[model samples]
Target chain A: MACDARGKTTTIKILTGLLRPSEGQAYIWGVDVEKEPEHAMSRVGAVVETPELYPELTPLEILTYVGRLREMSPDAIRDRSKVVLDEVKMSEWADKRTGKFSKGMKQRVGIAQALLNQPDLLILDEPTGGLDPRGMAEVRDVIKGLGRSGITVFMSSHLLYEVQETCDSVALINKGKLLMYDDLARISLWRKGGRVEVEALPPIPPEIVERVQAAPGVKSVRGPDGNRIVVELEGGDEERAALLRQLLGWGLRVRSFKDVEMPLESLYLELVKESR
Target chain B: MATEGATQPTVPQAPQPTVPQADRRTARGARFLIVARFELMRQLRRRRLLILLIITAIFLVLLIVVIQVFRTASADSYSYASSFGGFVPTLAALAATFFGADALVGEFEHRTGYLLFPQPVTRTSIFLGKLVAGFSLTAVTLAVYYGVVATATAIVTRGLPIEIAYSFLLAVLYSTAALGVAFVLSSTLKGTTSASVMTFAVLFLMLAIVTAIFSVADLRPDGNLAFAGGTISNILSGPYPQAYPGDTEFPGGPGPGGRFRVYSPAVPLSILVMAIWAAVGFGLAWALYRRKEMKG
Candidate 1:
């Protein structure tokens, strides 16, 4: 599963081989998380909500410590940590204490730590939460790259645009309930409708507005600009053709025609409203 | 086009090997050690710990000098040494108790616990690692104090006896037990200040007030019926009473000065009480930590 900043994601860390779920079981590469959690979690890397770095330690030192927990050799830890830090573009600040790092730098350090072992499942929550636009792009690219490398990326964020741009598939959750789970394109398909900006040859007649609203498969009709009326159709090409014919039959001139794609923010708000 | 594509060499492939499961486990252990080392290093670098150690060391040195000067001035050196030795356990207990009371509680107050809980490692490992580090630091401080006392005593007396050495060792052990009690209390208390206050209050009540009541009851005419006083006496004498009066004289008293009195509770009972407290405290900390939600 992959999620961008826009989707709601929930992550639970059940310690390797120590805890069993109260309701269900989780598996890691066919190994039960509760029964063989160590084996299962060995292939998992996570960057929880906050950067878990020790504030007193430098970024390099923190990475080295986490590397040691994995029992990596001294040379391997040094090499891997160097590469990860460089990947996160934090090598310049590797020696600086984490307490002094900005929010974006801390987020990068968190990502670097999570990517250390290159686990099969990389779970990140609001990975770009505190980053500026450039930092957000950097993290988004890193996550996309991880997904390309065959890692399952599960992320959750309140930013709809980020999720739409980064995720291949999304599961929309609100108040702990699943709203929609599908490919982004499929969700975006729900936005299909013909939108036209109409300026009458002379001027629009009230009779034409009534006639268009009364046409088949016309969901709604509104005049956004004085000279333009946007008609939302319920069907695809067939509905659009029928509406155009009816409008022409009413002697209304169609100045221009266009299709509108719903923005993710609007779609999210619509889903949230529908659920409620 | 096909020939050109074929002629273009692919990126060099690095050799990868399948590590055995045992090897992977070893790797994880290494990672845990790195984490443990980082934890220790962080504590070592703390200004508070450094200041505490420095202040403790200076105070210990001055305390030894004063004790030695007073011991030499008093003609009854043996009685003074014995009395002083008896107070060592209580003093050590008081220090360790207060130190332990702030151990975990302070971390919570500072919101540092959240940073460690979400890792792949279990809470047990985190707790054990921190406890080991904290205990080691406390032990080192206590050892330094012991060394200072020993040196001062030898200088004052011109030689040291085997009994003093034994008593000092026992005192160290009692301090460890007291530290365990405080550690457990630290985990139980919600706030660092409250934990410290409660720990000191409990130590003072048990060592001083309880001992005083017991002494008063033992002097009562009818030994059979002082309920609160008798209970206090039993509590003091039943387990780990510090000083037990033997065949030595009571110094600076009207009666003969050869009577010996035991004050603190017995070592074995103190150990048991401390162990139970540690166990319960640790158990509660583990449960609460395991269930705690990590907020961003």
Candidate 2:
């Protein structure tokens, strides 16, 4: 999900049973959180905000501790610890004290601990919040990999690109209320039509640009600066294909043609604007 | 608007059957042990515990030196060893303060509760588990302190006093009581350092001040934890000291009436009071911790 610094963490905490909601109720797998929190939380793994691990403990020891609390057996904890450490790419640092670890390394360990139980749901709050570009990419890859592996990953992030790249679905939250909830494909499609960016080989004449604008299903056309023109069209893949064919027939050597995806930032701004 | 269930997604996994309610009760017992074992390990790995141990060793060495060099004539085993017991309350206070004072509050203060509090175990199990671990640490320290005193007394007097064992028991009770109070402060306070300092101040300083005031006014200070802990040494004085406040008149001594007042609680009463402090303290700590919510 994508959200600002409002109640994202509070919502995650309440879901994870860290904080009791002042009113209403929350259930996990049909078990009520306030009534039977332990049972409700049994299959849920979460990293709320920045998880503060004990500096004195190694990642292996910490995972073992968490595993024991989860009531996993000795053999299971040992086996799963190895699997999760390798999953987060922390196998080499498993025995080193977390005190000496970088923030990124500790974050990887945090992810590893959350994955230790093979949870059905993994909730991560701002998983890449304090990371450098490389660190952010590394953690984002881990999260993406987990999502592909079929764990329902519910992650809260303010980074639009990160959400665009990582999540299949996005829920935009503002002021403790969900403003928009939809799949990424729908959100990425512009309101009128899909935008297509076409590159032709060399300087195209104004006649060719006019020809492109006059084509069927074309909403508007912009650019041709540096051999590229961005066209807003009325349809999806078939329409884009027809435009590509039409460009070739016009005797303009088309270099590259693809859809220009709307950035998540624009969609977020639009939602926030609409909510206001 | 009551918030209802925050459900987890049910995905098919490797056949780990759901535990029944009866079995969950048993799992809670196992979880309590897990918490206690790891809590003990956390305390053991801390630098503060090592520092406390070093301080304990130094204190023991000094007691040995004073026993051998300063006194040419050895006193009875009970009197000699019970003098060492007078310092037990202080040692207990230090151990409890170091381990117990930040036990619960540190999770929130340092934000480690983000990792811990979401687990399947209930808050009651966590609180009791940590309580046991803190009490265990303090109890072990008291045991070591008494062991040294016992060995030294046996070497000089060639006889061990039964009162020394009773005194050790009283000290252990007092230490657990001190730890209970520390956990209460730990669960209530927002900062770990504040909890630690306030626990030490309340147990080692404030309670003593209250007891002293009550004694000055010729009132029974039996209910005060510090006064209750006084039995650790009072029992060692032999015949259990005076149970009530009274003035001892001296014809030539310098006093308001040439009289010195004495106040000591009966040994049984002190034991009962310390137990109550421990029980009440743990109960109150658990009640507060279980209801606490993470807002930060």
Candidate 3:
């Protein structure tokens, strides 16, 4: 998220039939959400934007009610509700009224309610929006578990780290415009870094920076390290070898020269910067 | 109904037993009943119901105290019961306004529909469930009120009149009518508070407008809900009141007499009017509810 995440939530609400789209259409399982919302939404489960539970109801009660609406058998509803409550780690508070629960606890119950019908698609809009660090970790673990259970999870977040940690793929949006969307690994690899850090056995002199900057195929140079120099190469495999040879010819000992960087953060920043 | 037992759902004994939904119509009916059952239990658990119970009890007690203070509480129980008979429909209207008004709007206002609308049920199912829930609770709340009146009347008179049964039926019918009106307002409105206030105003204040309109028109207020309410209370007035031209000037004036004809509809006509309100209001509300998006 470059800024806000309203677009992610609005899209979820529209697909869940809680809101109507002014233009175009959305579908689930080949059924149109606008024209056949009952059919479409039945196949999808969503928890949108700080969903509030009935304060008078317990988690078991709310889940059972939702299951009953889905026409689950009474025993099935009971067992399913218990299973969902356990999945969200609220088995002990299953019987307690949610009126007195923390925001995180309410969010858990909301997630459990969404899981009652066990739909093919589970859409959660900021499932852990305002939780404390510990609360966020708990919810994130549950989400990650759900992600691995063969159920499709579509989660939106403004916290880049949270998305990086919990999501297999990421969609970054800015001001309703999708800036980038790809597998995290693939996106990270697209921008191969060209800078190499040289940890020299014998530290290079401060005046040697100008000579290294003047070396062929070396675009830039920085750092008078304990015994190292960083060289930004213009391109290719030969540039680093030539730069290392030149450094050694100057009576400098290089211990290790390595290209070490993942480009996801750089890519994200570049995209966001370009978009802005 | 025997479904009162079914409504109290527990864990099923069978393991994932499949109930075949052979048709959308049949499926809708089953879903309607399930949601209605859920909503009924929901209302029973609401704290506001308890408050309504308290308010009704205090009103009844004060009524009895007022009658006793007038030294007529000791009168023959049949007449005494009829003296306080009007409270039934009044309570029905009041209860419908208090509880039923917010039933549908709160589902959206409180964002409860976020959980409800994504289910396999249709909007009509949601509306019907809520209507049934409000009707069930209103009936129960009215039951307690009538219970006190009935038990006291029976104890003193040593007998129960068949006409009081008719009166009770009218009260329940009237309650259903009021619920229909409340639901119609709830489905179309945005907020619970506004829906409730407008529903209450439409329930009682409509009577004021009706009275004034008919008074100015020099016509009888036969089609009014309040008129049916009068017929409800009149069923226990020893005999069913007849419809006839009343002692009036047949012209415009706000005074009681010599103003305009007041229509005390015969039992059948009154029942017809109340039924129309119930059917049409309930139908229109369902229609509107189906189109009402959960924008919240």
Candidate 2 vs candidate 3, DockQ winner: 2
On TM-score, the stronger of 2 and 3 is 2
Q: Which stretches of model 2 miss by more than 4 angstroms?
A: A188-263, B1-26, B72-74, B239-260
lDDT of 3 at B154: 85
TM-score for chain B of each model, two decimals:
0.62, 0.86, 0.81
What is the fnat value (0 to 1) for candidate 1?
0.14
Residue B36, candidate 3: C-alpha displacement in angstroms: 2.0
DockQ of each: 0.19, 0.33, 0.25
**lDDT, each prediction:** 0.58, 0.79, 0.73
Candidate 3, Cα interface RMSD: 15.7
Q: Which CAPRI tier for candidate 2?
A: acceptable
Kindly list the per-residue Cα lDDT of model 3 for residues A234-264, writing each as its tens digit.
6545676787788778877777877643244
lDDT of 1 by residue, B1-296 (tens): 11111122222222222332113535444444444566668877665456556766776667666765665454332443453453454455555554466666655665544334434565456656666665666666666655665565566655554445555555555555556556666766777888777776665455455555654443422211111112212322211233432222244433455343333343444445545554665566556544443332
| RMSD list, candidates in order | 9.3, 5.3, 9.3
How well is each residue in B1-296 modelled by candidate 3, as lDDT tens digits? Answer: 11111122122221221233212333646777877887776777776678788988998889877766674534665566676677776687678877688888887888877777776677777777777778888888877877877876786566566666677788899889998998888888898898888887887777758866875776777788877677656666564443222334545656665455545556788889999999998999888887777764
List the candidate 3 regions with Cα displacement exceeding 4 Å: A173-180, A189-276, B1-28, B61-81, B147-151, B157-159, B241-261, B266-269
Write the residue-wise lDDT of candidate 2 on A1-276 in tens digits: 445666788788888878888777776666787778677777777888878888888999999988888777777778889998997889998898787788778778888878878887788999998889998888888888889887888888887778889989877767676666667787645333567888988988789899989999998999878899999887756678888899999898988987676556655555566567
Model 3 residue pairs with clashes: A74-B12, A75-B12, A203-A227
